[model samples]
Target chain A: MATRVQAAPFDLAAELAGFGQGPKVGAVVTFTGVVRDDSGTLRHMEIEHYPGMTERAIAAIEAEAAARWNLVDSLIVHRYGKLAPGEAIMMVATAAPHRGDAFAAAEYLMDYLKSRAPFWKKEFTAEGAEWVAAKSDDESALTRW
Target chain B: MIDVLYFAWVRERIGLPKERLATSAATVAELVAELRSREDRYAAAFADLDALRVALDQELSSFDAPLAGVREVAFFPPMTGG
Candidate 1:
């Protein structure tokens, strides 16, 4: 498992392909999160994450997933710095011997990351900027794991 | 002593991204209370506990959990960390 925190866009296809070692690992689940334009409702969004802590936190999540699943490879690419609409913001890929493991692990990582990781997102709208309210649904998702 | 970190909205409210602190708190909740007592900034930052999340030594954990032997305690907005 690997987690890269950088200011540049990542190549998700290449990342997932790298895990293609032996033929036994047949499944690959990839997720790409892109910046979406919320019309004028959202002018822009600011993402804040702990510098040293972001990497450490992400690695811990990956490690937990690796231990719980039969995964062969996993990659988490999260971008920082100023970003615009339609830009790639983050990606997650999981490879395993079976699709079920790969798919579930990838989804699990994403849901948990959204709810448990230490990142804050502030949205800029027509009126002004505001922190998106944390939802109860997100916390409930953690119980699924 | 531990390196305490704040991220996202927590940083915005606290006006700092990171800080170091020596504490007597035995649990994360106690630390949060300690921070809230420090100054107006910390009080404002930690005002809404429901909107906050915590990590001990970089691993997400409950606020009531012990932090006696931890190396770090991180406070942040409910994560959008993907």
Candidate 2:
């Protein structure tokens, strides 16, 4: 598995392909989250994370995914630093013997990540910059899985 | 002794990004209460405890968690990072 937290842009195609290997693994599912322009409603976003804790959180989430799913491999790439609208923010890919595990693990990983990760976003909006709040729905996603 | 960090609005509220603190408290909640007494900046930052998230040694943790064996502590807004 590959997990990266960097400032440079990532190649989803390369990442998905790199994670796909062996005839036993027939399905690979990936999710990419990007910063949307939102028609200028959001000027820019500042992503804040604790250097060491952010990684540890990601690793813990990945470990949880591995335990609950029949996954062959996984790649979680999350970028930090200032990001503009329409830029890729993060991606999660899972490979498994079947599409069921791959998709389930992919969603499970994202759901756990959204609710538990140690990162924050400050949005520069027309009203002013504000720290985004935790959404109940996002937190609720973890309950189903 | 522990290195504490604040991020985003939490940092803005505390008027600092980082600081080294010496404390006898055993849990994150105690440490926050101590800082809240230092000044209004800290009080405002920690006013809504539920909205904020805490990390011990760079891992997500609860407020009641002990500080024993901890080297770092961080507080920040809930995650919006995708």
Candidate 3:
């Protein structure tokens, strides 16, 4: 189990090294979120987070996901600060004995991280900057679990 | 004294990140009320309670929750993290 909140970019390859290698682990699922510029006018994206609460909240979510699934290992690494378009924002990796458990646990971690985490995103476009609003769909997604 | 923090637009509008305040407000709502009464900046930042979320002692909490032993209170908009 590992949770890292940093401003520096993380290498997906380095993060996955030796991951999900235990004898009982058969399935490993990974998800990565990238900074996208759909409008083609974005200058950058700035991410703000409550330092103390951010770590605590994410660790709690990870703990919950572990409790809900049979897992061998899990990792969550999120980035804060300015990120250019196409930059990797964050990633989650889950390893379990079966594909079903790995997939479900990864999804569960994402759904909770979307709304429960303390990070906030603001987009700087050609015209101005605006804070990204939380989506109602993201909140409702939690009801599925 | 309790540490009060504002984030995102709440921090921008209020023009600061955090402050230590001595208050007798019994709940989060009352603390908000007291801040709102301070000046235009606080009032404007807290004009709509629906747009804001609060945390007590770093844990997400409701505005009606008591402030008995909370050492930190944070106010911010809904999270957009993933």
Candidate 4:
């Protein structure tokens, strides 16, 4: 398992090049989140995170997924800093002997990362910038696990 | 001394990112109360307890949790990360 908190953009292809390369690995699941300009006026987004806590929280989330799922490998890469529309925000990958475990663990990591992680987002637009509020749906997603 | 941190709007509202203060408060709630009484900026930042989340030494915690051994305390709105 691996977790990374960085300010630099990650190459998805490069990240998955040798990921989950194991004889027993049968399935791999990956998810990527990107910035979107839903309001049309969005210029960019600024992501802020607690340096020490961000790494610790992601590590703890990864450990929890490992404990709950039978997997061969897993990786979480989340980025912070200025990102324009369509820029990748984060990605999660999971590998397991079965598709079910890989899929479920990937989803679990996302749900926990949404609410448990320390990162916050600020949207910049032509008009102004505003901090993104936590969604009730995001918090409720944790109940699934 | 405890290092107090504010993030996002809390940081913006308070006009600073962090500070070191010697506090005698025993719980997170008491710390909030003390900060709220300090100035209008702090009061505005902590006006609604329900809107905030607290962390002790980088670990998620409750406002009622004891602060006996915590070296750092952070206050911010609910996380919106993914």
Writing each residue's lDDT as its tens digit, candidate 3 over B1-82 gives: 9999999999999999999999999999999999999999999999999999999989999999999999999999999998
| Cα lDDT, model 4, residue A69 | 95
Q: Ten consecutive residues with minimal summed lDDT in candidate 4 chain A?
A: A136-145
Q: List the residue pairs that clash in candidate 3.
A: none
The parts of candidate 1 lying over 4 Å away from their true place are none
DockQ values, each candidate? 0.67, 0.75, 0.93, 0.92
Single out the weakest 10-residue window by summed lDDT for candidate 2 chain B: B73-82
Can you tell me which runs of candidate 4 are displaced by over 4 Å?
A: none
Model 2 lDDT tens row, A64-136: 8889988889989998878888888899999999999999999988887786776677788888887678898
lDDT of 2 by residue, B1-82 (tens): 7999998788887888999999999899999999999998899999999888888888778999999999989898878656
Clashing pairs in 4: none
Residue B75 C-alpha lDDT in model 3: 99
How far does residue B41 in candidate 1 sit from its true spot (Å)?
A: 2.6
Model 1, position A142: C-alpha lDDT score: 86
Q: Residue-wise lDDT of candidate 4 within A46-134, one digit each (tens)? A: 99999999999999999999999999999999999999999999999999999999999999999999999999999999999999999
Docking class of 2: medium
Q: What is the alpha-carbon interface RMSD for each candidate?
A: 1.7, 1.4, 0.4, 0.4
Model 3: TM-score for chain B:
0.99
